[model samples]
Target: MSIETSEPTGDTRSRAAIKNALGEQARALGFQTMRITRPDTIQKAGDRLLTFLADGRHGTMEWMEANADRRRDPRQLWSEARSVVMLAMSYAPETDPMEALARPLEGIVSAYAKRADYHDVMKVKLKQLATDLERETGDPVKVFVDTAPLMEKPLAQAAGIGWQGKHTNLVSRDDGSWLFLGAILTATELDPDPPERDHCGRCSRCLDACPTKAFPAPYQLDARRCIAYLTIEHKGHIAEEFRAPIGNRIFGCDDCLAVCPWNKFARSAHETRLHVRAELDNPPLADLLPLDDSAFRARFRGTPVKRTGRDRFVRNCLIAAGNSADRALLPFVAPLLSDPSALVRAMAVWAFRRLADPDAIGTARAEHYGCEQDEAVKKEWDAGTTT
Candidate 1:
C-alpha cells in the first residue's frame, strides 16, 4: 500500500505511545533491542562505501557497487521512509569459539551458522514487527534483513542500537559483537533515538587478532584477504597464501569478532531456534569430505552453509583437511582427486599434497596428473610434486 503523507488528525495515536508499544512488541518477538532513526541520518555511509568500492576492497561483490546509492541513504531506497527502526538479536555462543580453532582436524563453522539461518529467523520477526506497526499507525512499512541494500550497521548506530567498532561490525555495549541486525523502514513520523558514540578507544585487539590481517586500518576491511570472503563469497581456488591462515574455518571467520573485549557483557542467545546444533558445532573435516551433493544439502539443510553449494563447501573442507596434517584423512581425500568438479579435484590435490608423504604423493600424482585436463588442477599437481 502507498504511504499517507498527510498529517494525522485529532484521533491519531501519540508517537511516544506508538514507540513504547513497538519496543514491547519487538522484545516479545525475540529482538533484544530496538531503536528508531531518521532515514537520512547515515549521510557518511555512502562516501565510505564509495571509497571502499573505488579501492576494490569489496572484492567480487559487484552488487555493493550497483546498489551504492540506496545503500548509502535509506531515503534513496524509499522516498516516503521517514523513520528507520533498527533491531538487534543476540546469538552469543555458550562455549568459546576460539577453542574450535585449535582442533585443526575439525571444521570450525562460524557460531551464527551453527544454528538456523539468521536471515530466515530475523526476517520472520521483522515482518511481524512491521505488521504490528502498520496495524497501529496505518502507515506503509518495509522490512529488511542482511541481504537488503540498506547499510544496517550505520543505521543501527544512528538509531542508538549499537556503535560500529574497529572490526567494522556493529557492537552493542549490552549485547556486544554477537548481535544480528535487522531494520524496519516506515513512512510514519517517529522520534529518532540518540545516536551511539564510538566506544573503541586505543584498544586494537580486533585488529591484532586477525590471522590474515584483513583490516588495513581501524574500521576498514579488505575483503580479498578476509577468510570469510574467501570461504563464503569468492568462488574457485582459495589462494595458497591464505589456505594455512584459513585454518579449519569452513564457513565464516570470527577471529576479529571473537577477540573484541566488549563481548564480555554479551549474553547467550535467548531465541531457542538460534541455539547451536551439536553435530554442526565442530564437525570433523574427514566426515565433511565424503558428502556428495545430496549429503551436503541434507547436512546443511535450512542453514546458511547450504547456499555455498556442495562443490565450494567440500572445497573448503579440503583446505581444512590439508591444514589438518592428519594422515588418516588422506584415505578420505584420495577419492575426491577424481571428482567431477575441477574446483573439488583441485582442492583434493591440495589436501593430498599436504597430508601425503613423498611416496604417496608420487603415487597419486602419477594416477591423476596424466588425465587431469583442467589447467588449474594440473598446476596443483605440479605444485604438489615440487613441494
Candidate 2:
C-alpha cells in the first residue's frame, strides 16, 4: 500500500501532511509505531551512558566508549539530519522462555536470537523505508538499526515509542519488550513527539528475574555479570562465579526480558521466519558440545547463533554440560579436552570435573592430558583429579 507522493510545499501544513504520509508508510512496512524525534542535544543519552560507564557495567564492550560523543547526539553523525524516524518491529515468541531453564540438559537460547538474524530481517525493511522517504521528500535518509553508535533505546524513548524499563530496554505498551528498534535519520524537518513518561513505576520484575544479577540497580546493567555477555561477548575463560548460575543458556540469556509482566499483553508475531526452530529452541547440551565449524555453520546458517562461531558457542555448551548433572553426557564432553579452541578445552575440563566420575577423569587424563597444550586446561584437569 504505497502512498502517492505530492510535490513539496514549504508550509507548516505541508510538513504535517508529509509526517502523516511517513507514519502511514511505517505502518505499511510492519512497524508498530513511527515518530519523528528532533535531533538536538542528547542530555538523556549522555546521562544514560555516563551512569552505565561510571558503574563499570559495560564489561568488555569497549566499542560503546569509542564513539561516546557521537552516541550521545545523532547530529554528530550527520550534521544536516534534522529529524529521526524511530521504527519498531515486534518479534514476540509464543511459548514462555522460562520453560527451557527447567530442562537442564537442553540449551536455552535468548528469545531474540533464537530465530533468523534480526539484522537481516529489519535492515531490509529499513532500507525500503529510506528509499520511500527519499522518493516522497526528495531528501536523503540514513537508516540505522543496532549497528550504529547511536543510543537507540534513548532515541526510541524520546520518540515516544516506549520508555526504557528497569532492564534498560525500550518497552512499548503495544509490543512489550519484544520489539526490535530501528532508526532512519532524514534531512526532512518533521515535527517531534513529546517524550514518553516512565511507566515502570514500582515494577522491578526485570531486575529480580535476572539469573546472574546483571542489574546493579533499576535502569543499570553490569554486563560483566550478565550471562549474555559471558556466553556471546566475553572471549576468555568463563568466570567461575557465574558459571553454575548460567545454567544451560549457551547462546544468550533472556531471563530479565522473559520475566516482564508486560509480555502478557504481547501478541505472537505474524512473521513466520521469527518462529523458533525446534533444533535451536532446546538443543541437547551433549549434542551441542562437539559441533565442528562446518556442522555449526550448516545448522545455524541464517540464524543469529552463527555469529559466535563454533568454538565460542561450543565452549558455552561445555559449561551447560557441566551444570546439567546428566552424567550421561560425560563421555560426550570427555573428547573435547583436546579441543583446538583453548577456551573450549578449558571449559571441557570443567565439564569433565562436574559430569565425569573418577574413572572417567582418570581415563581422560591418562589418554589426553599429554596432548593438552593449554596450561589452563591442564590446571583444571589436575585440580579435578586431585579434588
Candidate 3:
C-alpha cells in the first residue's frame, strides 16, 4: 500500500507520523517488526569488524575485508542516508530442526534454505515499503536484504530489533533467533529507537552446542571451523577432522541457532514464502548423491543451495554418506569416484573407504587410482588405503 503525501508540520512530528505509517505498512508486507536508527548509530561495530577481519576468522570470505569501510558505517555506504529502518521476518521451523539430525539418511538443510532464496522473497516486500517511504518523505531510498556491504545485525541492534547473541547472530526476545533482517537506508531524517543491549549474559548454549567448536569464545566465531563454512563456502576438500562432525548437513549448519533457549518463543513463519518447500523438507541422501549438473539445476533452482553449484553440493553429500555408514548408499556413491569434478571425486574416495572393507577399497583403488589424473584424488586413494 502506498502512503499519501501530506503537508509537513514541524520536523519531529512529521518524521514521527512517517515512522508510524511505515510501521503499519511494514507489518502489512509480512515483516514482524520495524525499528529506526541513524546511519552513525553503530560506530563500535566498525571497530569490532576490523578485529574480526584482522584475526582472519572470516575465512575465505574476502569480500568482508574489501568492503570493510562501507560496512563500518552506513554513512560510508551512502553519503546522504539520514536514517535506517531495520526490519525482521520470521522463518522458524514448524517442527523441531533437531529431529532431522537423527534422520541420518536424510540430508539436513538449514531451516532458512528449505524455501526459495530469501533475498528474492524479502526484496519484493522491501521495495514496496521503499516506494511508500519515498512517497511519504519525498526522499530517495535504498533497500537491502542481507546483500551488499551493509552490516545488518549491527543495524538491527542499533534499531532496537535485537541483540547479537553469543553465536553472533541477532537474537530477539520476541522472535528468538529465527529472524531474517532487511534494511531501508533513506536520505530523510526519522526518529531513532533505543538500541537493544546484549541479553546473552550467562547463557552459553549457543557456544557449547557447536559440533565443530567453531566458537573460540562466547561471541567470536572461527568460520574456518564452522560447519556452515566447510559445507557451503569452503571450496577445497574438507579437512578429514571436520567431516565426521559435519554429520548429515548438506547446505548449512543450524546447531547454534537451534539450541538458543530464546527459541522457545519462536513461532513458525507467518509468511508462506519463508516456509520450507515440500520438496526440500526431507531430502534423502540417496536422491541427492547422484544429481548430475542439469538435474541438480532443475532440482535446486531459485533456492540458495543452487548458488553453491552441483559439484560443491554433491561434495557435501559425499561427506554425509561417508559419515552415514549405511552401506546402502555405496551403490549411488561408487559411480562418483569417476566424477569429473576433482572436488567430487576426492570426496567419493573418502566416502567409499568409510563404507567399503579393505578388500573392497583395494579393488576400487586399483581400478580408479591408476587412471586418476588429479593429485588430490590420488592422495585420497592412497590415504583411504591406510585408514
Model 3 scores a C-alpha lDDT of: 0.90
**Scored by CA lDDT, what does every candidate get?**
0.89, 0.83, 0.90
If both were scored by TM-score, which would come out higher, candidate 1 or candidate 2? 1
Q: Write the per-residue lDDT of candidate 2 for residues 1-387, one digit (tens) a residue.
A: 553546455777778888888788888777778877887835766877977776777877888888888888898888889999898888887888888889998999888888888888888888988887777777898999889888888888888988889998888887788998899999988889888888888999899998888887898878899898999988788777788899999998877888888888887776667777777887887678778999999989998899888999999998888888888897788788877789888888888888777786788789878987778877777775422
For every candidate structure, what is the RMSD over all alpha carbons to the true structure, in angstroms? 3.0, 1.9, 1.2
Q: What clash pairs does model 3 have?
A: none
lDDT of 2 at 271: 66
TM-score of each: 0.96, 0.95, 0.98
Model 3 residue 331 CA deviation (Å) reads 0.3
lDDT of 1 by residue, 164-275 (tens): 9998999989988999999999999888899999999999999999999999999999999999999999887888889889999999988888989889999999898898
Candidate 3 at 193: error in angstroms?
A: 0.4
lDDT of 2 at 206: 93
Which scores higher on TM-score, 2 or 3? 3
Greater TM-score among 1 and 3 belongs to 3
lDDT of 2 at 56: 71
**Candidate 2: which stretches are off by over 4 Å?**
5-8, 385-387
Error of 2 at 105 (Å): 1.8
RMSD of 3: 1.2
